[model samples]
Target chain A: MARLVTLVESGGPGVREVASALAPYAGHAQVIGLTGSPGVGKSTTTTALVAAYRREGKKVGVLAIDPSSPFSGGAILGDRIRMQEHATDPGVYIRSMSSRGHLGGLSATTPQAVRVLDGVGCDVILVETVGVGQAEVDIASLADTTLVLLAPGMGDGIQAVKAGILEIADVFVINKADRDGADHTLRDIRSMMALVTREPNEWRQPIVKTVAHKTEGLEELLEAIGKHHSWLAEHGELQRRRTARASAEITAIALGLLRARLDVTDELASAVAAGEMDPYAAADRLLG
Target chain B: MARLVTLVESGGPGVREVASALAPYAGHAQVIGLTGSPGVGKSTTTTALVAAYRREGKKVGVLAIDPSSPFSGGAILGDRIRMQEHATDPGVYIRSMSSRGHLGGLSATTPQAVRVLDGVGCDVILVETVGVGQAEVDIASLADTTLVLLAPGMGDGIQAVKAGILEIADVFVINKADRDGADHTLRDIRSMMALVTREPNEWRQPIVKTVAHKTEGLEELLEAIGKHHSWLAEHGELQRRRTARASAEITAIALGLLRARLDVTDELASAVAAGEMDPYAAADRLLG
Candidate 1:
């Protein structure tokens, strides 16, 4: 943790030393992914979880990925601001990142940020993405556990299923539970869940309802998270998931570096801009 | 047009061949980019414009990009359905693309699709994006003129300006012009535009009001597009913008290819499930 502090705080010499020193603890912490549509009280639910974990005497790191403000070049900053009540807590560390113009759900800096938090010895790392559409569910691969949040009255379950978020969910939480039609939403989610065949390692997704703003029913949420953790640990999937996540981190870093080196030309950009070249074709020609 | 049709339909030739054939009419057709927040009637405005153009004896191609449903590998397909009313018209060509899990705001096949439409000899291409968040804006760079659309009563101008969409507006349209606060939205947009100075060749971004469903103020909208187009040509900046855009497309394409080549392992899939790595980093690593 000490090694990573300097490494994270200082970018030059400290990074390598910290990377070498904190290499062992990389797989110890629990990484959880939380996602749903925007305005579903993600920030609120995350805050509740952080508080609950802290109450249990665990050090927690909350990483919130906010949509970037193109003009500001920073996070929309709403999620961070909403969680400011924890700003003074020593056991709670919070960081917010913008998508950084990357098209996928997670921010470009997110995996690195997660590694930094893990290296700092946080017992749990809560990674929250800006509510992305179905395609952004890629965040599921990064965590030991994945939670897909949904709300009542958010159109139909068919729309929800078609959204693709339902496919990646290991656990579903119907947040804003106090709203009318919560039961209908819950029933819809269960029916949708029934449509998919689960693997032996995967459990029936537990749907917990919560008015995230009030933090009600968070204990059940934590208990469910604990159950998921136990399931993974006993089956030995936790370590596998972690190692795979580390490998992904390396993969993203490596790809980012390679992309910087390709040095695409003006003619190619013109062709793409003019709609003459698709990204795949451009990629195929540049790399092939 | 024949070359593009062959490139898209046959896929035997590369993008360079299609680009080469389409180079002749680069200056004749003005490409427009339309974007806004989701549910803001971007489709309605785009449909209105396409209809207007076709009525004026201009052949139009509408390239609409929406995210695919990850579960079904199909799109909600709203854009295509919305514009299908004109499907039978020989002067109108409309194609819908799902983001198809790519984060760069375009599906891998978008460029090829555009070429196919262009090759069909459409006088103008109207590209409508899912929304003007980061990925959508990245996709919008594919167009010659980009329009940022906002609806009234969305929020204060502060909320609207801080969004990623406002930065790329070549022109701003307050769609749903019949709404109560449309004038206020226009005033706010003008006030916000006053605070920022654009590049020498860039237009001063006129704010137009349009009731897309009613077809109100579309003439003015067309006039605004025409004015921006003329402004770029008069200053000889049209070619410069087109060149820069093509260069960016090439750069983005090269990076995407490199990412794909390098990270074909199960590592990305696993971490992506965990929510730890974004698709772009994977793409970036491939670029390296």
Candidate 2:
């Protein structure tokens, strides 16, 4: 599985052949995405959830997508230390992918990585995105269920809504609930969600509180996840979401292939540089 | 000019014809880029540069690339007010571009906007990027001369070094030079630059002090920019940079073209979603 993940990440030659070999046995695992800002206990919650899912006699796969810039220190080292607890378990497989240099970003390799774990024998797959910004939205679109984490005083619900993070939440997990202002945070979130109009049949994202350090509220979080999964299956939303994610993944791969084959010659570049030809015309000529 | 810029920004039909028409005039403008962290007096310095350039009877164009998210009130509103002083000047063409929703980002439209200004007879084009991150690097590649701005006590030279911003500087301007720790900031930047080994004939970035509000050091800043421009021309690096920028621009347009034409059918999406075909294989099939 690690070898397969590495091959996909490298995006080198023979990647398609390997992916084709593994394609037959996938589509069984449930993909759950967890994401939040740093210091939101995402790693801890992911660890806790892994253990909970393991206790259910289920095999699990973990894909931790890191989006930190090359300059900033990434959280993967700390994650590896925490995940060492499950490293000896043959049934649990965990992988970390850095999306720093890839032009297609997460879409190019992440879905392929997920498909690898799904193909192998994992029953539940947890995709935890490290860091903030666009990675959250990407993970949300790619997963069957997305859990957006928040802590007290992180930001009020108004700020989250304005940031457009709330729109990606299938479920909201308020980690560090034992900290001060937890109630205030809950009220803020509730009030913000109230402002958005939804139909009667829409799924209301349940807010679950957890002190991941103490493993408190672990069972309730799992139950909420299970309920959401049930709702997805019942409404045929599962098929729709999986297909949508697949479409995006395929498009990104196609775009990457196109980028690689773009024939930009220095003569053409010189024309554009010399103001004898515009970029739009140069592109047309390149294709021509 | 305003209509042309708007059409390019929209990235709609008639773009190719518009671009082909303007392509012949783009190579004339001496493109200059100025960037810095927020609160570093970038706008004041830019305004000062414009006024000083106008005093020389030079026609100037300003393309302020705003990378701020929608949730945060961008510096554009403030920039427009500062630029109003130049609004009535027939010799100046000033436009603000927001890189918020465009899938191709600044690459898709900024070059076209610059081309329009260049085609319409602007002598000196100032490309000032509002805010930080990748936008700074983007503007650096697009300009003939790049000026990275800093202020006292924002971050020690070490943080700047760590941020990798120093590599993009052709000239450094320490704005707010009247503030305390001005000398310290200069020393920090100097020390950081000194650590990097440069070729004997390579251009050494000169650090200039500026109290932009009072218009102090404006002449020295302009002189340093002129020196760098001369160096770029004499060393054949100006053409290199322009061609490199053009190549990236052309490639972005090509990729945008390929993405638009990718044939991802619903049947193909379903197969990949069901794991009967991997995303990589699906992409190949779509292209094939």
Candidate 3:
């Protein structure tokens, strides 16, 4: 399993070989994305969710992508320490991916890693990311069920709304529910949802309140996730979402390869800089 | 000026024509990028800087890119209101670009808009953005001088360090300098900067403190920007930076056009799903 993940991360020729071998076994596991701002207890909620899934006698895998602290990898280390409860559980697998400053690299590599886990007999895969930036939002395209976690008194309601997190959330988990203003946060999300005019047949995103540190509300959150999964399957949205994911994954890879192929000549760049050629014309020439 | 900006933002076929026509008149403006977290008074600082530049009898253009509030365009509205001092000035042009949920689209469109501003007899161009994500970081490539603003008590020091904002900031502004912990924030940034190992000949990044709301320290901030501009020109870094920007812009455009051309078929995606083909192989087939 470690070797397969390494293959995917390396993004080398081996990725193709490993992916082809695992392709047949993929799509069996339910992929869930869990994301929220920092200090929102995403790690605690993820650990709770993993334990709950394991209670059902199912294998689980986690792919934690941390864009923060690329130099120290501190956040991922803290997460591993906190998740040690599952360290001895053979049914659980965990991996952490840190950003290496390559543009679009994380989004390109994550789906392949998830595919590997799916192929390796994990009954469930949870992709946990800090929902702070564009790369994190890209996870929405990959997961069958996306859970946007929010916490009370964090000013998260406004931040989440501003960041457009409301659009991607299938289940909104207001963690730290026991904290003051949790109900206010819940109301904020509900009011925001009320603003959207959805078709009657459309799935209404459910808000699940959780004090994740105490493991309270785990079952309800899980139930919401399960319900969303079922709704997706019933509406054939599962296939549509997966198809879109595959399309994006393929396009990202193709573009990465094309980038590797086309080296912008210094002369061309100098021409553009010298104001003798426009960037659009330069792009056209380079593409040719 | 507004029509040219519209043409660039539209990304229509006429963009190339407009770009080529304006190419000869470009490369004259000194583009400065100012970015920081929300509530850091970026608008206030931007307004002050525009006023300062105008006092020097120079034409200025401001492009405020807002990733948040794309739907309502509220940030731009706020900026216009704050910058109403220059509303009647024919020498100053202000435009706002909102994120339309397209990946790398802002980075793709911004340089064209900057080119338009540069073409239209603007001596100074200010590109203001919320320093939150990858698109904001990409602004470093487009600007001659990048100023990262941080306010006291904002926890921006740690956020800046985590986001690797240190590398991109050509100048750091400790805005709201009269607030408590202003010195602490300045010390934090200074300490962080002290850890960096720079060559003797390299231009060190300067930190400027400003009470932008009071219009204090505006001249010093402007002086820092001028110093950076002069340093860039003397070191030939200006040409080098523009060359790098053109390269990235060209690559992004080429990749975008390629994405439009490659259609991922359902059969191809299903083949990958069924383990009949790897994604790399699938991409190859699609490219072929």
Candidate 4:
């Protein structure tokens, strides 16, 4: 499993071979994406959810995408401490990935990693990301079920809406539910949801409240996720979402390869910099 | 000016015309990028900088990229209110752009807009972004000078370092200098900078303190920017940076066009989804 993940991350010729070999066994596992702002207890919630899934005798895999650097050691350490409960469970597999200074590396490597986990016979895969940037939104495209977590006093509702997080959330988890103004956060989300027009037959997102550190509301959160999965299967949205994900993955890989193949000459760059060549014309030359 | 911005935003045939027409006149303006986390008073600093530049009798243009949605109207309103001082000045042009759900859209259109401003003979161009994600880092590539702002209690130093903001920042500003712990923030950044190795003759990054709301430290910030600009010029780094920027811009445009041209068939998507076609092979097929 570690070797397969290394292959995917390397983005070498081995990736194609590994992906092809795993392709047949993929799509069996349910992929769930959990995203929320920092300090919202995403790690705690993720730990709780993993346990809840384990209680049902399901094998689970986790991929935590950490955007922070190793130098900022506290947050990553906290994640490890929260997730250590599952360390001895053979049914659970967990991995953390750092961005490694590449802007879109998380989006580029995550799908292949998920495919490897799926092929390895995980009953469910939870992909967790800090809800900050485009990378978090990319997780929505990859997941069959996406949970957007929020908490009172996180100043997240309007900010989340502005970031377009509301559109991607299938289940809105208001974590830290015991906090003051948790109800206000819940109401804020519901009213925001009301602003979004959806067809009558479309799935209405459910709000699940959780005090994740206390392991509260884990069952309902799991149930909401299960319900969303069932809805996707019933409406054929599962196939549609997977197809779109595949399309995006293929395009990203193709573009990366093309960029590598395209020899961007210093001469061309200098000419453009000197204003002797237009960028469009230079682009044409590069394409040729 | 508005029409040119619209044309660039449209990403139509007219973009090439606009870009080519402006290409020759570009490189004269000192493009400065100001980035920091939200509530760090990026807008306040930008307003102060604009006023300082205007006092220098330099024509200035501001491109404020708001990744948030228009529905979250308060933040945008705050930007407008802060920048209202320059609303009637013909020498100053300020425009706010939202991400509109397009990843890297700011990177895509910002250069063209800057070119338009440069063509009109602006002496300086200020690009302000909420220093959150990859997009803000992309601003570094496009700017001649990059200023990173931090507040006393913003918890930004470590986060900024993790985001790779420290590497890109040419000038570090500890804003809200009158606030408690401002000196600690300044000391923290200085200590962090101490860790990065640089050549003896390399331009050392300067830490500037500013209470932007009071318009204090404006002169020193402007002077630091001027010093960086001069250093880039003297060291021949200016041409090198622009060449890289143009190269990236051209490549991004070329790849965007290629993606548009690549015909993604539902059959290919389904085959990949079904595990019959490997994504790399599918990418090659789409390319062919």
Candidate 5:
């Protein structure tokens, strides 16, 4: 909208341009996060969503977060290899990023990466994090609407242990619906959701069952996302959530960089070498 | 043991004395990290190891890192709960820490927690990380030896995508040995191990088979850990690894604290409100 595409393509620039350029439609686009255990057909679900959105003439962006190779500091970069069918479509943009050895969550570049897609004029950004159970819930903090995808037969308490993810879902998608125990997963999620009380103004968490690979329930999934987004907007909760996420953005960036700096300090080196310090001590000293 | 029990009581304060007290057997105690996907019986394997170690008259300490509840900032603490049988034993000590939203792998207090145990005169400190997958590989840098546990049927190539975990494994344990596809998993690991050229003086990654809960094949597992220790010492790799991990401990500590800080920022609140930021952005901005 602001000739932002040209500015962003100019080598390297501040992210503010990207953020501000994309700010106008920030509320218009439906940004949904999809996360679940590995082998849960997350990719298939994403593909169907892309097709569904495009069928409606809506532009979409898919930011797939893959696991990074610790040795090379690059993403395993396999998801793209398989999802090349949409590579030539102008209405869709797919970008892959390595979680970059980030143990507890997604990479530091994820937000700016999402902003890049936003600046590119996507009406929807489907951010997918790697399958790491609860820790992968980091996506919920950034997404306007968060969806936790689960397959059938993931076991009872296993879902409960994912406190990291359970607390954040606006919608729970029981994907691979054709599989056995899909209903059980749905019921389990509903039971879990029932235990979690939404904020006074927040919408009730919805559970939808879908066979993502077949596009069996893409319409219902889309509807659920739409319902959640609109609910937030009507209650003005959308604006409140996004602002809090932005401030979190500043703190996350500040800490990530500072941590990288402290990771390479001389004192830390001497301490480890002398056997006089541990990570816990180094943390205190580094923060101090 | 330098009255190391007092240090464990004070938590953080006991790290120095514990490290010093453990220094005498630092070379002898083999700190092995066990991690893998959920349902892989990491706790069962840890339990089996403790039993085996105790039978040999060796004291073992287990530091089980569980996913913490964001609301209460406390662990659901499932690992230890499942490990109740060992709770009443005098020779075995178990401590649990919640991720408490620390994204660099373990919680801010984890390293200190590990140190507290190290000082308590335990011969071995077994750290069980919340194994959602590769993101939890930070344990490799914490333990002197690391075992990346995998199950039989995670689908082909799933492990290949796990570059982070694979690179860090001093040993690989394919647990649930009696499962139908156990052989395939064993072969997969061996083949993957073959892909990398072993370091000149370091030990090759060994894949061991075990059914942990049944206490089956644990002797071989302990043998592997012991052999790995001997290999490290014989090759000077143990000291080298410890030195490296020590430095990582400091850096990860700094990052852990920073992560903790960002987790609670007003900015996060704003971003969540505005829908402009997600946790990935929050975490990234915190890092940046």
Candidate 6:
């Protein structure tokens, strides 16, 4: 599994072949994505969740996507330290993925990683990432169910972070529930949700509170996720989501193939470089 | 000029016409990009630099890229407050571009913005961006010379921000140098530069300290930029960089065209979405 994931990480014809071989056995695992701002106990919550799933006698896979920013530490070891309790558990698989710098927004091969874990014996895969903004949105697009985590005493920080993340979250988990101002944060989220207009039959994103370090409220969190899963199946939303996800996969793959076909020869590039021809004109010639 | 930039921002056939119309007169302007972490006096320094250049009766264009991250305030008004000195000058054109979220790193149309500025008779175009991650690196690739700003007493924050930025920076401007530990920051940059092996004739990245608010050391900064520009010309690096930049532009254009050629019928997407066929196979059908 690790070897296949490494191939997916490197990403080329080999990974494509691996993906093709695995496609027959894939699409069985539940893909759950967790995202939140730094200092919100995301890693702790991910570790606790892994234990919860493993207790059910099911295999679990954790893909911790370390932020690609230079400001972030090389934190693969740090994540291992936190997940040490699951170190010896054969039922749990944890991997930290980091992007090559300047590759643009989150790694392109993340969906492939999830596909790899699904094709293995894992029944549940948790895709956890750090930071808000575009990264969180991308996570939501890739996951079967997306959980957006927050904590108390963040004050206006919560207000700031909630802007674009409100729609993409499937479950809202206010971690560190024992901390001060937990009630205030809950009230703020309630008010914000009130502002969002939703259809009467739409799935209302439930808010759950937990102190993830102590594994408090693990049962309640599991109940919320299970209810969401059932709701997805009943409303035919599961198939819709899978179809949308597959469409995105197909589109991304098509774009890659198109990029490979771009015929920017040295002579054309040199002409644009020399200002003797503009890029649009040069591209025109190359395309012809 | 504003209309053309708008067309470029929309990114389609209109921009193609606009670019082709302007390409004949482009390639004369010097594109200088400034990037740094927030609060490093980037805007103030840019304001000061604009005034200094305007003193020589040169037309200048400032393109301030408001970061796409949710954490940043919508600061187009803030940037304008600092550059109000140039507000009345017809020769100075300043535009603040805020990107649509999840649109990816920086903006794909940034080069087209530069092309518009150059064709409109701007002698020097300043592309300014905030943040210390992939955004900074993208700015460096788009500009002839990239300036990285640092403030005194940023402490470990300075250490963290300098990782990927050091190699791309053609000039290091230590803004807020009036504060304490200015010399300390200067030394850190010098030692860091020392670690990078360079040929004897290679242009050394010069460190210039400035209290941007007070407009101290403006002449030295300009001189350093002038020297770097001269060195780039003498070494034939300018042509090489432009060719690489044009190659990227041409490839981006070609990709856009190839994407239009993809024949993803609803049946193919439906097959992948329904799980009857995998995405890679669907992509192959679309490409066929």
Q: lDDT: which candidate is best?
A: 3
Please, what is the TM-score per model?
Answer: 0.85, 0.78, 0.91, 0.93, 0.82, 0.84
* DockQ score of each predicted structure, in the order shown: 0.34, 0.37, 0.44, 0.45, 0.34, 0.37
Q: Which ten residues in a row have the lowest lDDT in candidate 3 chain B?
A: B67-76
- Model 1 lDDT per residue over A175-239, tens place: 98899999998888878777888787566778898887888888889888989889888988886
Candidate 5: how close is chain B to the reference, as a TM-score? Answer: 0.77
Candidate 3 lDDT tens digits, A11-122: 8766777877788887899999988876799889989989999999999999888765443333336677778999889999988776443344256678888889999999
Q: Model 3, A243: alpha-carbon shift in Å? A: 1.3
Error of 4 at B276 (Å): 1.6
Local error of candidate 1 at A215, Å? Answer: 1.8
lDDT score at residue A123, model 5, on the 0-100 scale: 91
Better of 2 and 3 by TM-score: 3
What are the per-residue Cα lDDT tens digits for candidate 5 across A1-288?
Answer: 223432332214555445554544444456789877676778888888888888999999887876434344335556666667787898888776555544345535566566556655789989886545333556787788988888887645732556656677788888888988987777777776778776786577878889987888888999999888888889877777666555544555566556546645665655654555544555576677
Residue pairs in candidate 2 whose N, alpha carbon or C atoms collide under 3 angstroms: none
Off by over 4 Å in 4: A68-78, A99-106, A156-163, B68-78, B100-105, B156-163
Q: On residues A22-112, what C-alpha lDDT tens digit does candidate 4 reach at each position?
A: 8889789999999887778888888988988899999999988775442221245446556898988999988876543232425567888
Worst 10-residue lDDT window for candidate 6 chain A reads A98-107
What global local distance difference test value does model 6 have?
0.76
* Fraction of native Cα contacts reproduced by each candidate: 0.33, 0.58, 0.48, 0.41, 0.37, 0.41
Stretches > 4 Å off in candidate 2: A34-96, A101-104, A122-136, A149-163, A173-195, A207-224, B30-105, B121-137, B145-197, B204-227
**Clashes (candidate 4):** 0
On TM-score, who's better, 4 or 5? 4
lDDT of 2 at A148: 83
CAPRI level of candidate 4: acceptable
List chain B TM-scores, each candidate.
Answer: 0.79, 0.91, 0.93, 0.93, 0.77, 0.88
Candidate 2: give the TM-score of chain A: 0.92
